[model samples]
Target: MSTRPAAGRCLVDLSAQDRLRSRAPERAPMLRVLCCPPAGAAAGYWRFLVREDVHVLGAQYPGRESRFREPAAPTVEALAAEAAAAVAAAPWARAAITPGASADVPLVVLGHSMGASVAAELASRLEHREGIRVALLALSAKTAPGTAEVASTGAGTGAGSDEDLREGLDPLAPGADAAMVRWLRRLGGTPEAVLEHPELLALQLPALRADLRVSMAYDRFPAPVGAPLLLLRGTEDVTVDPGGLEAWRPVSTGPVQRREYPGGHHPLADHGDRLLEDLLACAASGRSG
Candidate 1:
């Protein structure tokens, strides 16, 4: 893989009604958060979460963000492993190295949607394989592994062929057509230019296909995880089935807690503020749950 410079900050002009935005604190922070985006999505999508005393670091997977110039990983396990490596090597390595952070502020993992599983797997890899200690894990939208009762991990709503992958993803992308763009607008997956650019489309689809494959063929972790796990879901979430949530019971080694929102599939976005409060509350109240 080739090395590329970090994405240079660029300014985008948007209407107040059309633009998505978040506020970051202007001073030093106590805790730093490592955030991972959902599948078919890029890093920095969670820019809205930066706030007072909180520094949010969004993990950029290969094939997206500055890593877009590099080759995408072929499997979820590979991707998860790669992300774990990056976290171990980050500039703040001293803050949350193996065995947990040295400071009082806890090292937290907040993964939304597909990110929930990705985050869980990352924590598992770090602790079980790499010997890193994760203070707490906040998993949103996705159920615990083996818990998604209404949905199966393998074979998504989209067909398996690369061509089908392109077609299924095109709608979630930005520029297919007014109708397709509208569809993507609702999904909130990619940027308008990416959906319109063929070059970027070429870069994104293979990675997207690989992630879907990971989702489908993914097997549960060999054993239950030891970290405190908090599961969040939406009452109206189409992708998260109740049976799926129930399935998570057997896979977690620590105490398991569930929080359900009143919205659809994307519960975090629908209940971002409430979700953030609950996550912080959960992390601050205890050591091991």
Candidate 2:
């Protein structure tokens, strides 16, 4: 991969929203949940998760959406650090300390697929470096960090030639071409129009490939995180083993809960309402405890 300058900041500004639109009163502290999208996806993937009580801010990765021209992050650490910086700088992080609030507002981190590991790293960074408390960490459709290799299907190291890259992605899209369309079809998120267009698919491949490399190359620490954890998996998600989902129990010192939904890999889309309800309940439980 060609070395390039880091991408421009992609954080979405929630502070700019009209205060009247906030369902929570000025004196009422609200939970802020920062979400990280899965590989080959952008922040917009979480737009369907909008809620009136909690603030849902999605982390935008490089080389996608508004950041399409920038280079994708080379490592999971780089991505996590950048995301942490963006979250720490957000106005809500400081607003929690304002006089009207009864207590410090809670912050929760949620991620899906490859983003599970990224969210874990971000939670650790916030807790250790910024002294921020992560009320809960919600992970979906991914195994514990440092364990992906155990179940990975021998995909190429993500650093091979173009043909090798295509070959590695073959299992992901058996009879289809190694294009974004194939992956998008398998994942069931991207719009049909975008997937059908060769030009659009080409535009998404760089970031997708970069994110895959980060997942393949990630090296996680053995130590567990301090925050409570909730693992959500799709019952039909063949990509992640049930045992692997259960394995996350030991990764957190706080309580760990697992829930299964009826869908494939993208359970959030199929079960967004249920997941959101559970996420809020988990975060509240963690905060109260």
Candidate 3:
């Protein structure tokens, strides 16, 4: 794992001012989004989801921003564990619905690609440890756990061990930084400076591997999560492969809204308002108030 600051603290600082202003007793958020980023991506990647209707919280793993100084985790489990710890430590510990209250302040958790798996695990952790109910668990672009056979066409399929993730990243190193930079360029993320800086890669390498592990090895809980679920697939997404969406049907007890958008995997990047509208629409009138 790459070492930086805590992922939770960075998110809190980045959105603190806006979050305070958006808080209203009647109009408080019906959902608190905890977006997990795919391999090599950071929490800010989902900044498009932030709005007045929902309290959006994005988790920045180690080696990114405030947490950039901390060593990154090497495995997906470690990353999820870190995320689970962060969620547990966060100040907003209230359950989706207040105890004995008729109105359930729903929490809609959205994860894209690898982040989707982490979101599911986090939700499970929240349910088992904190006993908080997840109103909705939205998994996009990635397969739900125990459904790895469907992801055979992906670049690196199946749950990966720590050694597997380490080996996967072994091809790039001090000598292959240039090749890595070229790869990052096509990925369309990461700053030029970060790409050029050897030190930064040293920090990011762990995060990249950890993210890949999280993506590869994530398993959905067998016992159905006590929440509505959604699976969003981009018809054109060639990277993650949309095969997993079909498998979600049997698992989702509540309304399972599966959408096939025209764009590639990251639909929110091009269809921010549309996606936000869909997410916000899940909020009940009473809950939104």
RMSD of each: 6.6, 5.2, 5.3
- Per-residue alpha-carbon lDDT of model 1 for 207-255, expressed as tens digits? 6655655665565653555666777767866555665655556545767
After superposition, candidate 3 runs with Cα above 4 Å error: 1-7, 10-14, 17-27, 95-97, 100-104, 146-168, 171-206, 219-223, 248-252, 283-289
Give me the displacement of residue 245 in model 2, in angstroms. 1.9
TM-score, structure 3 vs. true? 0.74
lDDT tens digits by residue: candidate 2, 1-289: 9353332245653422324566544334366778888888887677667656567777788888777887778887788888877776765666433434455667778988878878878888877776667888888887655444323221211232234345535435654334435445655556788767768866766677678778767656424667789988887775677676666676579998888999877878777788778887898898678
Cα-based lDDT at residue 102, candidate 2: 53
Model 2 ranges with Cα > 4 A deviation: 1-8, 13-29, 95-103, 148-180
Candidates sorted by lDDT, best first = 2, 3, 1
Instruction: Give the C-alpha miss distance for residue 173 in model 3, angstroms.
Output: 5.9
TM-score per prediction, in order, is: 0.71, 0.80, 0.74
As for candidate 1, its clashing pairs are: 147-244, 147-247, 148-244, 149-243, 149-244, 153-216, 154-216, 174-195, 237-264, 237-265
Query: Which is the leading candidate under lDDT?
Result: 2
Off by over 4 Å in 1: 1-30, 97-102, 143-206
How are the candidates ranked when ordered by TM-score, highest leading? 2, 3, 1
After TM-score superposition, the amount by which residue 123's alpha carbon in candidate 1 deviates from its true location, in angstroms, is: 0.4
lDDT of 3 by residue, 17-61 (tens): 466676633346655677777777777787766666567777677
Top TM-score: which candidate number? 2
